[model samples]
Target: MMSNSTGLLLHNAKDDDDEQSPFEEVAANISNKDDPTILCLTFRSVFIGILLTCFDSVVFQFFAYRTSPLDINIGLIILLAYMMGEFMSKVLPEKIFNITINPGAFSIKEHALITIMATSGTTTTFAIKAITVQRIYYNYPVTHVNGILFILVMHLLAFSIAGILKRYLVWPASMIWPKTLMSCCLMRILNIENQTETTETRWTMSRSKFFWLVVLFQFLWYWFPGYIFPLLSMFSFICMIAPHNIVFSQITGANGLGLGVLQFD
Candidate 1:
């Protein structure tokens, strides 16, 4: 009877495993969850998130004008947020006696949420250019209130359009974007405060250390293209040879209207 019962228990466990969906299993095993004390979204989240959004938007916009447009990587942003969030949590006062600004210690989830919010806000809306055109080209200034309203209306319309398309575009398993999956993994890794130590791995550097090293390399490298070696951005042969010819300058110059661009460093 005990043998039969053990066999039944094993069968039930197998059944349970079989019943679980692959996605469910993955979510259960791989999802990032830790101490529940840190709140994910708060007024602070909105504040910092919006600020990050604005900063990233401005930086990217400035670079967009360059001959070699540089993308402000979201991963770098996330890393920055992680470091900042961690620092702020340790330094900032949790609460000032009764009156509190920060209710509890900062959490990784908070950092992730802020990063995500800033990322979403980084994409400047189409309405912004429309407003810009009116303000600059036509010299018709849109009032601050009108600008806010325009943004609100545009976002609402976009959200509605997204909802309408989600059923057909997003529901299918095959439609899931690989980059999005990678983003999810990245977020999880970034937010996870404590990682399991592996003895098998021979690499000595921590991920955070590696990230900083890469950042330092990129930071130093950017100066070449951005300032020191301007030719690195666009080494136009025509610009070099026909530096005086207006027609050739127009055809190959990065600053002027050009027929084509050639970039090498």
Candidate 2:
């Protein structure tokens, strides 16, 4: 009886240790907890999501024609959605036509849903590219109705393929994507409340404050490389030293072979 009890205790201890082991990247970043009461598909979220989607699609498609296309990433959309949600909460009346438009404080779930919708809209579909190529290069003009159908068909096909491969590609523990992890981390950081208690650091800044500061710094810094001095974008000292040397250009030039090239921008 004593021997059996000892063996059982050892087994339980092993299980406990396994439970307390270092978490996987997905588990570490994403929360497993679900709040049933949290409103995800509220009027405000849908409104903001659709609005941003239209704005992003138009802006992105317009920029696609430019030499340097501008892309509105998911992070920007997330931040924008949060601000809009907050604004609506404060300005909008509690009940309109006996319907709850602003459901108290903006929940994280709503923020996440809006982010997903806005991000989806920002992506320029392959169908658009294919249609453009067909029309311009092949000289095959498609009717407006036919173009819409073609886009729909392409999307449906893609969704079907994704559904089929999801088990192997998405559900597996080994299929860890760095980009997905980064997005999840950003979402968590944005949603989490700032710690009021000050730390012992020289500059005690909140997460949101730090994020905005970085954005401001990057915005100011980009002007130098992007417009003021384009050469600063790809400054290769070796190429400057030997402008006429083919070997040096091949090894150090940004447009060439670029063997030992380093870009600061």
Candidate 3:
């Protein structure tokens, strides 16, 4: 009787495993588990989300006209939000004026919510492009009020469309967004306790330390190609060999066909 029960339990476990999604990364990183008691829409999450959104929108819009534009990707935002969330959890008082402020440790759900909000805000709206084109190319004056209304309407339409499609696109288990999966994995990693000790790697460096190290290296290295020597941005040997040759320039120049351009930036 004992042997039969054990065999039946193993069979059920195998069936459960087979029913899981085929994507190994998704299965490994994402948990099917949920805790309904956990707080998601806390003060920290809202404040951090709005702050990062405004920051990202302003920075990207300001740098859009530059020869090399800069973008703060969701991965960086996840890291920043994680750091800020942790900081707030530790610094903020538990309760003030009969209200709860710090709600225990930073949770993965709160981090994911903040990340989604921040990511949504970073996207450039189509209305901005339309307004710019009308004013610049068509010479059509777009008043401030009209421009604001246009943007608001466009956003509303986009949200409405997304809501209509949510059932087919978002609810399905097969709908695995690779970019969002990456953010999910990052959130899981950040929320894990004693990650530095639990993780075994040859690098021997913590994730935060490694992140800062890479940022520092990129910052110092970009100067060479970005400003110090712009030519280094696109080093075409063929163009150098035949500077006066229009055919060679067209085939290999950075601004042209770029057939054999070697760029570091």
Q: Could you say which candidate leads in lDDT?
A: 3
Question: How far is 115's C-alpha from truth in model 1 (Å)?
Answer: 1.8
What 10-residue stretch in candidate 1 is worst by lDDT? 25-34
Best by TM-score: 2
Sort by lDDT, top down from the best: 3, 2, 1
- TM-score versus the correct structure, for each prediction: 0.58, 0.77, 0.72
Query: Residue 24 of candidate 1: its Cα lDDT?
Result: 51
Q: Give the TM-score of candidate 3.
A: 0.72
Candidate with the larger lDDT of 1 and 3: 3
Model 2 off-target regions past 4 Å? Answer: 1-24, 65-67, 171-174, 194-206, 227-231, 243-246
Better of 1 and 2 by lDDT: 2
Q: In terms of TM-score, which candidate is stronger, 1 or 3?
A: 3
Residues 1-265 of candidate 3: C-alpha lDDT, one tens digit per residue: 5698899999976664455556888877777656878899998999999999899888887887689888788888998999999999999999999888888988888898899888886768889989999999999989999999999999999999999998788655566889888888777767863245445655566565565678799999999999999988899988899899998899989989999899888
Tell me the lDDT of candidate 1: 0.70
